[model samples]
Target: MKNLIKINSKINENGSIDFKELNIDDFKEFDYYRIVNPITKEIFYNDNGKLKLIHNCHCYDIWGNNKSCDYCVSTNALVTNSTKKKLEQIDGNLFLARVFPIIFDDKTYVLELFQDIGDSYVKTENENLQLSQIVTQLNLLASKDSFSGLFSHGFMYNKIMEITRDNIMPVALLCMDIDNMKYINDNFGHYEGDVLIKKISDELIKLNSDNVFAARTGGDEFQVIFINYTKEMALDYSKPILDNLEKILIKDNYYASTSWAIEDRIKNQNAKELIESADSKMYKVKDIHHKN
Candidate 1:
């Protein structure tokens, strides 16, 4: 089945399909086919032998998912320029998707061929749904903090490595720490300290979006990475958190306060250096709070 799809179909310099000896008729064996720009998530399909792009239509729309898949095979194929396959469930039916990296108009794209395999693979719709839920839970357990429900420290480290390796620019990192956490724990008890952490997590979660990745990196330390954002923009986005924390009263008139630092990715800075820079700047802010 893998041999049916060619690995690298190239577009000619003149802007015509080279096909690279690939027979387009072989695609007919699949139930449906679509060309996708992995970065933009745009969907394009053949219309009477001509390719046409669908406006505002994403591949995830077919799966009825609100966002992109956590492990996106199409994006993987585009990144590695390799053929990949994954089983996707849509509308209670199983689909086998074979992704092949191709060049269209000198830009990389993925050709996704989907064939329905529900009857052969899935026993019942309810069973499939249960399996999907279990997988989602396992993924959450592996990547998320148990108490705060934000991403774990390990996940944040891996994400930083990915961003650095990929050289994704215009990124900002926000390092945050709850001020006087030990003081709160000693005076109010550990339970109250836990409550304060959860309150801080709730505030951070409110800032989460498609471009924001928030993680609880330590006991009272949180980090947020903003993609495609400048340092100024990231600071502006986080100002509300400071204002909100000032109003949160945990108990006994003690307010939930935090010290944070925001730093933009600099040229040639690795993941470790970037994180260290942010952490150092955060401590400076904490020092100021202590002096007061």
Candidate 2:
């Protein structure tokens, strides 16, 4: 039955299943269906037979996990070229997922059909609110850096990739690293070093807005992404941050300082290249600071 359905289904040029054209109602048994890129975890909802890609959303979002599932049936179906099933439990709700691999435009994708299997129970308003709060807290713990209260490196990387791939233009990448961090940690106590880092992070947090995303990428490294801003505007925005850092006194004589570089998005540049460009320029600034 599955083989006959697969042979009859028409694949559109955009790699979506032409459900209306095929007039196949075999999928009506499933409560909901989604097509997913097994490798990237990119999700697409099947809308009346056409697949519509969901932006900045992954399969993991539903599971509330920081990473991919250990035993992902979608990827497994893609590998084995057969149907697979997994029973998943999320927030006390049970769901059964049927995964099957399909090929379109020479690319393989997984079709996941999900059905709720948990005991039917109506929840009170308070229960729904509690579930919402739990999910929000879980997401925050997954995406936020513990110490700095900023977005984590993994979150930043995924966000940048989403922005770039979606062609959300006029974005700027600003990479910054603390100056003489090793020296500070060695000469001053590590406690003082921690204090300095916190101070810098506090300043970065103040810069966060709807269009600006700041993240603590490493021990002494940070990244601030400015969306819908040109190079000059991003520079103007960052100037006050630099000024604020200059005012942060770690000790009586020494002040906190950072070397930063900003790179505006260019045509055909991926997220990694944009970050590396700013990172390379930041090192040059750091060299000049060292010499001075």
Candidate 3:
């Protein structure tokens, strides 16, 4: 999903996008156009993730779906407050999907646009150009995660290796995970659990400053790499997230118990070793918290 259209110069506080002035004919090049309410998450779908049609759109004609797509990009864009652009393969046909967040009618929504680009691009580009484009596409695929605005795990691993191999100075790694996530999902429902996860991710985003890279490595696990940071400094930085998250409670227990381990970059340490050491420390902290 890419920023395919500049629909509005700025989104207002009420979350309304005014496209009344734009000519719809100019957007005829797009294959599909739809709007989604992100805050409601009340798309035309069953509570159990089934697609159910509630709005009139070209979805039925394009994909034969009366309901929201299972892998809706709007859902993710709202969670991350970021634009989502990607190539999607729908029923063997390829499409370029672009999901953009828009404020409309005092509510947060998303504009979803797609174009069928299956074989057209391949046939249009020359052989040499296609090869170069494929390489660039592969690089992007390895760099960013699809679901949220976080660095990909593979890219994070490469960063760790580069820092350790070069013996970079003033580098530290913090590994953190949400506590009792399964319990939350089971009891509070997955929808609410997803909201909780988004909240946690948002908190982590707040801590993303200069040289601090954050990534989601596991189901409920997050890894942070800090350039020019120490264990104590990392803890100090994470304190705000901890404080902010403490207010969320579940069944009298905190919604999430976060444990992070900070490890310094050393010549002897590799990415795997650093992760292991950090995991051990994080588990110890989590254990103590659970016991208390």
Cα lDDT listed for each candidate: 0.74, 0.72, 0.61
Kindly list the per-residue Cα lDDT of model 1 for residues 1-292, writing each as its tens digit: 2112332233335533443433345454466566787666788655554556888667777766786655566765665566777766656666678888887557777888877776555567778778677646665565667899887675676566557655646889999998898988899999998988998898898888888888898899999988888899998887877678765688877686888889988977777899999999999999999898
Give the local distance difference test score of model 3.
Answer: 0.61
Q: Estimate each model's TM-score.
A: 0.56, 0.62, 0.51
Model 1, TM vs. native? 0.56
Model 2 per-residue lDDT tens digits across residues 1-292: 1111222233345644444342344455555566788668888655554656788777877776776653456665675576776665455555567778876556778877766665533266676556556545555565667899987775677666656765647889999999989888988889999988898998899888888889898899999988888889988987888688755577868776889888888877787789988899999999999898
Report lDDT (Cα) of residue 83, candidate 3.
Answer: 79
Q: Native-vs-model 2 lDDT?
A: 0.72
Candidate 1, which ten residues in sequence have the lowest lDDT sum? 1-10
Off by over 4 Å in 3: 1-142, 250-254
**Candidates ranked, most accurate by TM-score first:** 2, 1, 3
In model 2, residue pairs whose N, Cα or C atoms come closer than 3 Å (at least 3 residues apart or on different chains), thus clashing, are none
Candidates 1 and 2, the one with greater TM-score:
2
